[model samples]
Target: MTLNVLFAARPERWESYEPILKSEFARQGLDVALSTDHPPETVDYIIYAPNGPVQDFTAYTRCKAVMNLWAGVEQIVGNETLTQPLTRMVEEGLTGGMAEWVTGHTLRYHLEMDLDLARKPGDWSQHNPPLARDRPVTILGLGQLGQAAGQMLAGIGFPVTGWSRTQKDIEGITCLSGDEGLIEALKTAQVLVLLLPDTPATTNIINPESLALLPKGAVILNPGRGPLIDDDALLAALDLGQVAHATLDVFRTEPLPEDHPYWHHPKVTVTPHIAAETRPATAARVVAENIRRGEAGEPFLYLVDRDQGY
Candidate 1:
């Protein structure tokens, strides 16, 4: 039987993903009618993006699942019209990309590479940096991306601590959860990394109270959701020397306005959200595997919990 799968993202995305998805479906021995224009009632699955054309899922009566093209589900998880099971992207490429980016920035701060890079013609200021073992790094969110980054950081000899809404038992990393755990995690975070999902509970999670918990002059790296940090509070912390520097890859606004203070802040490095991306090649394989699983009556991978809003 041919499964009708709807490619519900932008036209450009369809242009890139069409051939890859077709190859993956064929490799899995699945006959899939994959197209951008599948009738809603006939769509067996949807490869979706939050900004995709299909906003209302009410017409998709036969869709077994909606496979998100991105890791984040905050935008579509709350759609009341959609009752189908939703799965977020958790492909190897995306996870590895995040781990690499997080590890690179963590090392930069740990070694104070920026200071060396800014040396003058004759400025030979002797500065010794501590080893990774001496630096305690804390990562918010222990999901796949978080765990991958935490493990990489731990492998490099940094003491890694990971926090989440629930307890996790990953080897080589100290895992913490809940209110008390968050306090402890913050207290020891010499280099803090935010990889948490965008949820109501996580909005402004790095506000004044939380910022104060970190050791003074601590550094921050945010590659997660934009709204995770309170912009005003972070600016205050940076000015007060509570946070020495912040390398932000995500923000509340994309193409962050030219007038934004972060653009000119001495303590802030603004990166244009290039931390991690869902590579089409690996991501297509993941989407195919999930569709295959759905057809075979197997549980889908990376299923989002609606109540938790991840």
Candidate 2:
């Protein structure tokens, strides 16, 4: 039997992924009908991106699942018409890229090497930096990216503490969870890193209370979702000298407006969402594998749970 699949993202991606996607499906020896659009009556599976133009899924009676191309599903989970199973992308390339970015930035802050590069000519100043052991790093949201980052930081002799919504015991990590645990974990950390997904429980999670738990002049790094931190609270913390500086990657708004305060803040570093991205080659392989499974009567991988909202 042939499974009819419709891809909802743009043709630009199809043009880029057609070769490898088709080749991989061929290797699996599955009979499938693959196209950007045929007819909703024939669509058995949908390769989706939240930003895609498939708002109405009431016509998709045959679709078994909605496979997302990206890791985040916040944009589409609440659609009442989307009754089929939804799955988020969880591929090798994304995880690896996230790990590398987190490690690179952590090391940069740990060594305080940026100060020397920012110095003017002949304005050399002798400064002795503290050892890695002296830097207590706290990682918020001990999920995939956070766990990987925490482990890497710990390997370099920095004391790593990780916090999540639920308790976990990771080797080489001082793991904590729950509301009370979050405060205690923050108190011990000199550098705080945010890597939580955007959800109701996570939105504006980094408020004044949590910021106050950290030691004075603490540094913050956020490469995760922008909504994870309370913007007003973070700004206030920076003003009071509780937070020395903040390095933010993702933001609530993309292509952040020129008039935004974050753009002109002297203590904040805004990177235009370049932390990590899913490579086309690897991501295409992951999509193909799921399509192969759907044909072979096997369960899909990285299926998203709408209840969890991730």
Q: Which candidate gets the maximum TM-score versus the true structure?
A: 1
Compared with the true structure, the alpha-carbon lDDT of candidate 1 equals 0.95
Q: List the residue pairs that clash in candidate 2.
A: none
User: How displaced is residue 99 in candidate 1, in Å?
Assistant: 0.4
Error of 1 at 204 (Å): 1.4
Model 2, span 1-310: residue lDDT tens: 8878787887677787667667776777766678887699889889888777788999999898898888778888888899998888877778778877877777777778689879899987877879989989999988777888888888888899999999999988999999899988999878899988899999988998888889998989999899988999999999899998898998898888898888899888888888877677788778878877876789988877788887
| Residue-by-residue lDDT tens digits, candidate 1, 78-130 | 99998999999999999999999999999898888998999889998888899
Which residue ranges in model 2 land beyond 4 Å of their true spot? none
Worst 10 residues of 2 by lDDT: 16-25
Candidate 1: the clashing residue pairs are: none
Q: Can you tell me which runs of candidate 1 are displaced by over 4 Å?
A: none
